[model samples]
Every structure is written in C-alpha cells, then in structure tokens.
Target: MRNSLRFKVALFFSVLTIALLLAQALGVRALAEAQEERLIAALIRDDMTNVLKGYQANPALLPPFDVRMNGYVSGADRESVALPATVRNLPFGTHEIIIDEREIHVAIAPMGTAGTARLYRVYDFNIYEKHFKEVINALMGGTGIFALLTIWLSFGLSGLLVRQVAGLARQVKTLRLGESAPIQPGKYDETELAGLVEAFNDYHQRMAGMIAREKAFTGNVSHELRTPLTTIKTSCELLEQDAAIRGKSRARLQQIERAADNMRELANALLMLAREDSACEVEPVAMAKMIETALTPFADRLAQKGLQTTIDIDGDLHVMANRPALAIVLSNLVDNAVRHTDRGGLHFRYAEGWLSIEDTGPGIPAHAIPHVFDRFYQAGSPDASPAGVGIGLSIVRKLCERYGWPIEIGSEPGQGTRVSLRLPAASRT
Candidate 1:
C-alpha cells in the first residue's frame, strides 16, 4: 500500500512467479490426465470390440459367465493390471469401469435378446492409477526447474539496482558545507532515482545561497557596530582629558566607554563564530605575555578586593591561534574571576602546551559542567550574574576549537573551579 518501488516490484514479481508455477502445475496435470484418459479409452474400445466378436461367434456363451486375460504386459511397462467389471448389465458399444481404483472408459457390444441382452463384453485399461502417479511426478519436476530460474532472475535484477543506489549514498555523505554551489550528482536518465537526485540538489542550492546571505549580513553588522564604538571610545578619552571632570566623572565615563568597547568585541566574536566556514590568520601568541596583558587591566580591581594574583607561566610558551580570539577568551575569564573572588587569590599557570586558570571562589557544581560552555547557559551563581552575558565561555570554546585546542573544565561545589586551555604543540603538528 505504501507504493515504494522496491516493495511493489518484489511483491509483483513474487506473485507472478507463483502464478507461473500454479499455471504450469495445473496445465501439465490437466494435459497428462486427458492424455491418459484417451489412452485408456482407446485400449478399452479395441479390447471390448474384439471380445464381443468372439462371444457372438459362439452362441453357447450364456448367463453367469466370466472372462479374464493375462494380468501383465511385459513390453513397455512391468506394471501389473486387473481387468475391470461393470456392476450393472449393459447392452451397448461402450461402458465405464474402475481401472485399478481409477474411473476409466470401456466399450461393450451386445447382440440379440431385448431386456436380457444376449452377448456382452467389457475391457478396461487397468493400470490408470499408476499412470496418474507418473504424470504428477513429471508435472512437479517441471515446476521446480522453472521456480529456480525465477529466483535467479529476481536476485540478479535487485543486485544491479542496489549497486547504483549505494554509490549515490556514498557521494552524498562527503558533500562539503563551504561549496558555493550544491553538487550535481551523476545523471541516470529516465529513471525515478535520477529525478530524486535532481530534487535533492535543487534544495541544497537554495540552502547554500541562504546561508551565504546570512553570513554577509552578520559580518556587515559587526563592522558597522565597531565604527561607532571606536568613535565613542575616542570621545571618552577626549572628555577625560579635560581638567574639570578629572576627579570622578571622567573616570566613570571612561569605564562606560570601555564597556562599550567590550560589547563591540563580543559582537565581532559572535559574527565570526556564526559561520563554520569562517577562517582566521593564525600567529604564535606568547602564552605568558597574552595572560599579562589581559590581567593588567584587572590589576586595580584585584588590589581593591584584597585578592592575590599568581602567575606560574614560563618565558615564551606559545600557542598558534588567532590573537584577537585569544584576547577575548582571557579578557572574559579574568574579568569574571575578578568579579567572583572577594578575598581568595586567582592563579594562572601554563604547563606543556596548556594554560590553566583557577579561582578560589565556590566552583561550579558537577552537574553544571556539561553545559558550562553552552551559550546563555549560566548556573544560578553570583559570578554567573555579574559581568556575564553567558556568551563569553561559549565564544572561548569556539575559538579553542578553531585553534585545534581542547578545553577542560574541573569544578566542585564550595571548593574551587579550574579551566584548562590545551593547545596542540608545533612538534605535534
């Protein structure tokens, strides 16, 4: 009922094969039975004629008489036979009698005597039951040969079709996301499967065009936003330069300006990460230097909170990655850590090719670690609320993936939290 081609074909062919079998079986059986019936009928007719002639020649043959012939014939077959008799009296040229438990025709000719019938004779082909068995075996044997050929043809056709279908599946799997146009599959003319490939390719083309347009729009929005941020930051610096507003208001204005800049940077990161095809220039960024630059701006905040900052990074341990991305990652982390810790210290360390940041504030709960890097996923903690857009860690994870870096998170409730930045070393490459 589903109308799928393979199912329909299988069902139709199987039924056809069965039909062919049944027809052959019935046809052969009917033909053989007719042939045997005619064969028995002709023999009975001749034998009945001969016996009637012999009885007519002898007028002494009268009532309560019986006649028999040799039970076996040795030439064509070794089958044993039994002569048959009619239960009722007959007057005619032919009569029907049982030939070895099978109904067969016999001929009879009687002369003289009106109600009694003076002369009567019967002859039967008595091996009809044995002949029936032979015919059945022969019909069944022919059916078996035809059935085998049907199965072979069915398998051959299915194999040919399945091979081409499997090839199409393989090609579809390796299709790339960055191609400007969808793949045009190899054509198989005048086939329903070929039409299906064309339909899929048409849909793919439309989807690719839509994705490209979205990327262009997002990139344009990010660039447009950066221009206004730069102007506002410059205006803030000029406003802070005035001697009149220097004491308190000028500082507050600068902070407002800095926050705007951070927002602009965050927007840019979102744009770049939105498209998986986005590419960036990789550079060797000194792990220690990058951490120092990010932490320097937070130094005053740490000092005010009476929280110690420790760094155990070596001289020039480096990672290959986009510098702007690295800056955003560390900026968000250091900012979040400063906001979270009131008294306890924060430590930054690098070992092998991994940079780790650990904070003494109440760490993330174990259950929350799975979703900690997800966008807009923030546990109901004080740090998650303050200085958080919930997109920072998500951005960090994306950048780490672009850099071929693996990120690890370790946290325990009421203890501490540690985030590790693992980079593939130059030697590994």
Candidate 2:
C-alpha cells in the first residue's frame, strides 16, 4: 500500500494537517491561559477593594463570599484573619502560594489608618486550573475530529487523481503490436490529466500510421517480387529439359531452380506475415502431401549431403489449417533440418497431435538451445553454407506462436536434435 501514489498523497496531507492543528491548539491554549490569569487578577483586586470599603463602614454587614475565595484582615481576632507565615510578612502585592496542599492566588493591600492592619484576598487556583483543562480537552477533541475528516478528504481526492493515471496506463498496455487503431482521448476535468491523455492519443496515431505503412510496403514488395520469381523458375525448368545441357551446367541450372523455389516460398511467407489479419480459409490438408511439397525444394541439398529421409505418418492423416500459412511453417522447419545435418538421416513422425523432426547432425549446445528460435541467432558456429542466416527457425517459431501451437526443441551434445510442434486437437481432427 505504501508504494501506491494515492496512499502516499493521503498520508502526506494527513500529517501536515495534524501538525498544523497541534500548533494552533498550543498557541490558543497559551493565549487563553494568559487572558484567564489577567481576568482573575483584576476580579480579585476589585473584590478586595469593595470588601475593604464595606468593612470600614460596617464590618459585620460584609458577609463571606463564595467558598472559593476568602478575606483576611490583620489585627482582627478571627481564625480566617490569621494568615499563613508565607503570606503574613508579604508586602502589598499580588502573590501565588500553596497552603495545606491547595494552590491560592493572593491580593494584599493596606486596610486602615493603623499601620499594622492589612487585607489579604485569596482565590482558589484549582477552579481556574480545572476550567483551563476542560478548554484544552475540548480543543484537542475537535482537532482529532477535524484530522480524521481531513484524512478522508485527502484519500478521496487522491483516488480521483490516481484513477485517471491508471486508466491511461491500461490503455497503453492494450495497444498490441499489430493494432492499427489510435487510442481515444479520455474525458477528465483535471488539466494535467486531460493533457496527458491528449499527448498519448497523438503518439498512438503516429505509431499506428507507421505500422500500417510498414505492412503495406512489405506486402507490395513481396507481391511485386513474386511475378519475376515465377518467370525465372519457369525458365529454369524449361532449360533443365534441354538435351544440350548436361553435367556441371545442368547441376547449376538445378541449383537455380531450387533457389527460385525457396525464394517464392519465402515471399509468400512474408506476405502472410505482413497482413494484419489471419482470415485465410481453413481446409483439411493431407500430411503426406504437405511434407512432400515442403521437401521438394530441399531435395538437391539432401541428395548432395547423402542424408536419408524417413516419414512415419499415416497416409490418410490430415490437419486442418490455413494452407499457405501451414506451408510456410512446414517449409521452414524442413529447411532448417536439411541445412544442419551433414550426415546420417532426417526423420519425421506424427503421434498424439505432435509433428516432430529429428536430425542426426552436430547437436546444438545446451547454452544455445534457449536462443535458437531468436532471429539471426546462430546455434553453434558460423556455417560456410549461405543457407544459415538463422531466420528460418525464427519464422517457424512466429507461425507457431500465431496459431497457438507449442514448439519444443531437445538436443544433447553428441546425440542429435529433435524439434516437436504440438498441434491443436481441432487441427488433428
């Protein structure tokens, strides 16, 4: 909770408000105490003056005041007239004293023409002390109530602010890689929040435009290149049929044909990948035919390396998928297998909705296996063959991810590598 911005903002304001309240309470209590003291002193002096005048006129007529106050007259033969030693010898002035564990405020003045006669008026200090305490308690109680209200208000306001920020964050997170639509500006009363939403909307528009342009360019280039590639492939096939071409020259023409076929497959894959949607028609595809078509372009390479190929799938087994997309996936996988194996055989198997390709080549190192599907990541060492640009496996991984298929690769140092592509149950059906 402490990491949350709303919590921090509320806490900050709450502490500040409490501190201010405490300071104000202390200042007000001090001022009240000073005023109370002055008022008590004035009342005491006035009462003493009135009693002295009445005593001079008729001493018996001046009855005792409230029990909280007492009047003492020196030279009078009365118990109340006998003052404590602490105040008995004091001069005519106001004094504070404690007698019999009771605090008193005293006012002394001359009583009569006799030099020895004097008046002492005393007021109980407990009354003023109790009232001051009550005032302070009330102030503190009010401060506490106000503090709670302030904290609640702070949390409410901060929540409103943080909610706007969180909404913006969620919108940005939902902007996927292929999303072409721009984000809409959110409605907010706060100027800063509205400005932030506006800025994000602008950025979203620019990014969407850039992605659309990139996809268009890729599609156009791939489409334009396909016509010429088909022409070259057809010309190469025609030349291969000529009786005059033979030996090394015929092999060169065959290589050109294989290269052209690979190029066409790559172009088709690029066009499919560049499209924003995967709405191609799904149809039942024969596993045997798919494998045969994928392997045709690699026949020259497999023959050159003397690598034996094996297929262990039922002839009637079929998978449901978009034909062109699945073609790219299978071709890339086959091409990767053919490029790596220098000797021994390549094997394919289908069981339990999984299609696996096993190759008996120098196995990928354990450290390199994790990054083998990354774009342009060479598995072991630099290959002298021009075929290993390291993007075939990456494209295969991308297609599998798009179709929600799980792909796994297992390899040991000296033993060979096996790649398994787990198809959906619906695909197998």
As for candidate 2, its clashing pairs are: none
Candidate 1, residues 1-429, lDDT tens digits: the string is: 465444555556766996889897988788878887787667666665565455568645433433332111111134333443333344454556565565544344444444333333334344556767876987788788777777677656765666666566766787765643454555554377688788878777777778889878887887788888888888887887788886578668867876886777688777767756444567777777888898887776788788888889766577777777788788888876777677698999887778889999778888889998898888766554455667788888888787677889898887778888886444324
lDDT per residue, candidate 2, 63-179, as tens digits? 443222233433221334334755666878888887677666777776546745556665666766887789889998998899889899989988886887777677778877555
Which parts of model 1 are misplaced by more than 4 Å?
A: 1-186, 279-283, 365-371, 380-385, 401-404
Model 2: residues with Cα > 4 Å off, grouped in runs? 1-159, 162-187, 279-289, 299-306, 313-323, 350-354, 365-371, 374-385, 400-406, 427-429
Candidate 2 Cα deviation (angstroms), residue 226: 1.3
Superposition error at 45 for model 1 (Å): 33
Q: What is the C-alpha lDDT of each candidate?
A: 0.69, 0.77
